[model samples]
Target: MLDELLARIEGRDFTIGIIGMGYVGLPLALTAVDRGFRVLGFDVDPDRVAQLNAGVSAIKHIPSASIAAAVSAGSFSATCDMNRLGEPDAILIAVPTPLDRHQDPDLSYVVKSTEAIARRLRAGQLVVLESTTWPGTTTEVMKPILEAGGLRAGKDFFLAFSPEREDPGNPKYSNAIIPKVVGADDPASRALACRLYDNLVAGTVPVSSSATAEAVKLTENIFRSVNIALVNELKLIYDAMGINVWEVIDAAKSKPFGYMAFYPGPGLGGHCIPIDPFYLSWKAREFEVPTRFIELAGLINNAMPQHVVHRLAEAIDKQSGRGLNGARVLIIGMAYKKNVDDMRESPSLRLTELIEARGAHTDYHDPHIPVIPRTREHAALAGRQSVALTPEVLASYDAVLIATDHDDVDWGHVVAHARLVVDTRNACAGIDTDKVVRA
Candidate 1:
């Protein structure tokens, strides 16, 4: 059965159905279509479906021309309907796996999407999960769900886990160029999934099992979280000794071996780095094991936002001759990282709340994000608009905090006009300024 599916995929006779047309799914769908597969994008969000159907790319990294050309060529289309699943030869799940308020792995999206796919499961159809999740999520949670349609995996159907490695705002590495990691419950299923990805991506790396594939994805993010925490902890220590961590990192990066530099910041942000490690830490608890490094990294990274607030207070008091209470504080960027609109789990929200809690008037400016959403701790400060980062506007605030270092922002203007600046992202590295404080 897997051989037959592979033959059909090789002939470009497969209809690829990509579920959840967000950052990961949209790019994958486009790449599949580019590789000559007839692709159907399914999403529960009506707005996203509408945008894709209209040939408008909502994701910043994806080119509108690429989507428009794909749609116009009749190889790609999007719908909110689940019935479209039956038309595809293979299905890919790219839904979000976020954490809940208790910091537990929220698998609601994964579970719901799995059930929807299972309802339309057909014989000889391959299923691949592209969401970043825990080790047992694919074989344990999703396998049984797919088997509910009376189709056995690796026999009547195929299932695999191929986590999406999407780096938003990166023009160098794309969906097609990044190496894909593929693993399945059985060898047949693995080969089928591997062939499918190899045709679309630059290369396909096969893993031992679905659990190993899932754990591989988690390990990558956990490595980043731990290293980032190490640097953040060192930032605090080096600050007390009047040492610049950025300069130290610059000098240390000169060594070729055994040192990959990870910078300290206000806090961790984005969907994967800040939250995905905790998913592994949560799953490790089941086997009477503890992920001490992940937990410690999360603790240190989570606390950095509040630490930035405290640093801002000191900077404002020393430079502006005022307390945090009632002082005007401006956040330069709200997006999680530089030059991207994605703000999921961005620490800037927490930084904003910490400032507001201290009775400071906080505002933000992001070309990508026009308005800030109302988070649990920042409901009262909702509906804030992005102020223009001009010289005049920069001078109006008591202090400006560089939360995100977007490319469009005028760092020179900010360095020249602002009375005091708390540089969390090292965005003001080249600019000469006396009132700059690195957080």
Candidate 2:
């Protein structure tokens, strides 16, 4: 089975099945198809599958032309049916591993995907989980499910863990450029997974065990969460001392050796940084270990949205001679980070909730997001559409809050027309007017 799979991969004669056509899975499918391998994408969303099959991209950063070209080449397909799972020689799981309401690891999607594959399990096929999850999930949780089909892992079939590293809207990197990390309990499974990814990406880093590969992904995110929390703490301190944290970051980053700059924003956004660290923390409790640093970082990062609201209130009181009650405010960007339509863990929504609770009228304008969709937490704020950022629209608001630093917004126009602007992302840096205040 291993030799046959390797031969097909080497000859580029195999079909790659990616279960979950989300931010991670879509890019993987496109990359594999571009490399001359037939690719099949599976998703529970019938609308998403239909849209992809019709040559439309559900994600903003990925162009529809690319999807169209791949479909035209007869190498890319998407489906909601699980019966087609046996068609591919290799099935990769890139489903989401989100947190539940109690902040516990929610592996429901991963479990469902595994069960779907287990029902269709066959010999000579490889199964790789690319979800960011707890360390022992590949072996402890998925192994039992996959073996329920009466086939053994690494013998009848292959099993490995290779976490997906998809950074949306990052032009400098892609699936083909970033190096992949593959690990498995068995040597044959590790080699097969490495060979598969090495053909698609720039390189592959092999590790001793699947748990180590899972830890690698968590460690990378934990480092980011901690460093961001450090900067956010510094931002608070510097704000009290009347020093600009952005300027400090600029001067400190000039050292070029030991310092890496991570800017302070409204808060952490996107899927990985805000959520992946908690997976490790949750798993650590099994052995009675306390992740104090992760806990503190989570606390600090979680409080950033409230701090931004406080600053906005102070600024609005000083500028307009009124309290937050009935203050008309416009948020510049709604998408979590800059230049992307992904709002997975965006702080802007929480900030909006905070401001609105104080009787302030909240509206937003995002170039990428047309309307606020129903989120896991803020479903009540749905149906709110993006307001136009014309000069008249800017003048109508009491304060314009720059929650996200999207490249398309004209900060100069905002500074010139708005009564006041609270720049949380430091989007308007050099504008020296009193209307432009750094939050």
Candidate 3:
């Protein structure tokens, strides 16, 4: 079965089914189509499926023209129906693995996707999970669910875990350019996954087991979370000392070999960095171990939004006699990062909520995100439209809080017009103005 799947992958004759069709899955589909593999993208959202069917991109960085080209060539298509799951030779699950209310790992999406695939299980099919999940999820959690049909994993159907390594707005290290890490408990599954990814990406890193691959992804995110937490802590300390943490980092990173810089922002954002660390920390508790550094980092990162909001409130009080009880604040950049529309786990959402909870009216402006979409965490903020960043609009607000430092905005215009500027991202660094206060 492995040999057959490997041959089909090498020949690019087999269809690839990608579940979720969001950031990770869409890029994977594009890369697969780019490599001449026909792809069927599955998503539960009917509207998203219809839009994709018409080749309209929902993401900012992924161009509609690319989707149109893929559709025109009959290389890719999106569907809400899961009945066609059996048609694909290789099925990749790239669903969301968000944290639950208690900040524990939520594997419902992964479980549901796996169950759907299990119902349509066929012999010689390769199933690879590309979701960010706790270790043993691919084996302990998903393996039993998949094998309920009595088909063995390695012999009848191959299973593996290859966590998605997608940087949403980064073109340099795209899904195609990034080396894939493929892991399976069995050699055949591992070999098949490696063979499939080898054809799609620049390189394939074959690990020993699925848990190791999961651990690799978690470790990468934890490293980031810890570094970002350190930087965030430094930002707080330096702020208290009246020292510029950004400047300190800039000079410190000049020693190329010794240091790698991680910038401090309003808080942690994106799918992996904010959430993946918790998956490891949660899983470690099962082994009767405490992930002290990771938990501390989470606490530090989580507190950043409150800190930024306090700074904004403080700026409002300092500018006028009135505090943030009824102040009107405009947030610059609603997106999590610069030049991207992805707002999953974005600090901006928390900032807006925090600001409003303190009796302040907050509106946002982002070049990428014009309308805030409905999210699990920030559903109340949905349907909110992005306000224009005109001088009149800027002047109307009591203070302008810069959450995301998008490169497209004219920082000079912002600093010139706003009464108070609380810069969370150092966005107005180039602009010389006493009005700008680093958050």
Task: Give the number of the best model, judged by TM-score.
Answer: 2
**Which pairs of residues clash in candidate 3, taking residues 3 or more apart in a chain or in different chains?**
none
Q: Which segments of candidate 1 are over 4 A away from where they belong?
A: 373-382
Candidates arranged by TM-score, highest first: 2, 3, 1
Model 2 worst lDDT run, 10 consecutive residues: 430-439
Please give the lDDT score at residue 278 for candidate 3.
88
Better of 1 and 2 by TM-score: 2
Candidate 3 regions exceeding 4 Å error are none
Give the alpha carbon lDDT tens digit for every residue of 1-439 in model 2: 6888888899998889999998999999999998889999999999999999999999999999999999988999899999999999899999889999999999999999999999998987889999999999999999999999799988998999998999998989998999999999999899899999999999999999999999999999999999999999999999999999999999999996999999888988888999998999999999999999999999999999999999999999997779699999999888999999998889999999999999999999999999988987899988899999889999998899999999998889889999999999988888888788787
What Cα-based lDDT does every candidate model obtain?
A: 0.89, 0.93, 0.92
- Cα lDDT for residue 100, model 3? 90
Candidate 3 versus truth, CA RMSD in Å, comes to 1.0
- In model 1, pairs of residues that clash are none
lDDT by residue for model 1 (47-159), tens: 98999989999877688899999999999999999977888998999998888889899999999988988888989888899999999999999999989778999889889
Compute the lDDT for candidate 1. 0.89
